[model samples]
Target: MQSYVNVRHSAQGHPSGVSVLCVSSELCNRLGACHITMCGTGMQRCTLNVTLEQAMILSRNHGLMPRCIMQTMDIMRKQGPRVELSAKNLKVMDQMTPAFPRLFKLCLPPSDGDL
Candidate 1:
């Protein structure tokens, strides 16, 4: 039923719709573990294809961006995350404003400039 639904939705003009693949165990054995490179990690991973804005949003939402740019350099390098950033995203990252690190549970007072 879900397959039928997917087909129907796909047929209805959603070209970028998510795709699903199901294969028999026999086929899986035959295919084996073919070399497949993956981007992202765990829940912080990005989609197979993503835009620059999307990438920035994902990284920020995942708390990958650092509040302190200089300090986070080591952390970002050590993690070695492969984010396919666009030119725009790169520019924004370069001029990033000071803010709390992503995913930090501790409360931070709002920036002094803001009321």
Candidate 2:
């Protein structure tokens, strides 16, 4: 099992992030689903039954940038499975690491309230 957090930061460094849990091919076969948590102004969680390769391909073809795909894979390889990306956990992480590089390129513009 492997996972990575794809974080985006506003110009003022506010985090608007999405966390992805990348399941390896073997693990995907065994577990049959991967948990995904998306965080920004709010959070949503879902389960998807897809292997790492399938995920990469789908993301690439469906508008995810190339750099994001590469970085996500790299993080997954290095980090293994450590953090569970629930909303509370992500908020804790946001507090701990406020300066992570803007990993997500396709970010929506922050609303006036976010500023």
Candidate 3:
């Protein structure tokens, strides 16, 4: 079996706390997780595979706008080919990227003739 390290926030309190998990592709499928990979500084690759329900909870709990969430997910997915975002999702992602740089790292330029 493939091995991976997962990070989780302490279950005490802090409602807005963040929990991160890192898992390999094989382990991800074995655990029935939907994974999203992100590229960090220094070319480090990070994988996030929080459950869909947990993501929805984070969205609602943190009062995050839908567009912002999509953009953040887009930025994360851009690191690898494992995840696919829909066209409508791309639209929302485009709208949020420029406006919320603090929430996501959108270093990529607009695609094709989006200029």
C-alpha lDDT score of every prediction, in listed order: 0.34, 0.44, 0.41
Q: Predictions ranked by TM-score, top down?
A: 3, 2, 1
> Model 1 segments beyond 4 Å from truth?
1-17, 21-32, 35-90, 94-115
- Residues 11-100, candidate 3, lDDT per residue (tens digit)? 574432223331244356567775555454312233334332233444546775544554455555664432433332457444423343
- RMSD to the hidden true structure, all candidates: 20.4, 15.4, 16.6
Top candidate by TM-score: 3
By summed lDDT, the worst window of 10 consecutive residues in model 3 runs over 1-10
Q: Global lDDT for candidate 2? A: 0.44
Q: Summarize candidate 2's per-residue lDDT along 1-115 as a digit string, tens digits.
A: 1233355577899864333343344344467664333345222222222224544654645765545665655555445433344434567545544443364323545778888
Clashes of each: 0, 0, 0
The 10-residue segment with the lowest total lDDT in model 2:
42-51
Which residue pairs come into collision in candidate 3?
none
Off by over 4 Å in 3: 1-55, 79-115
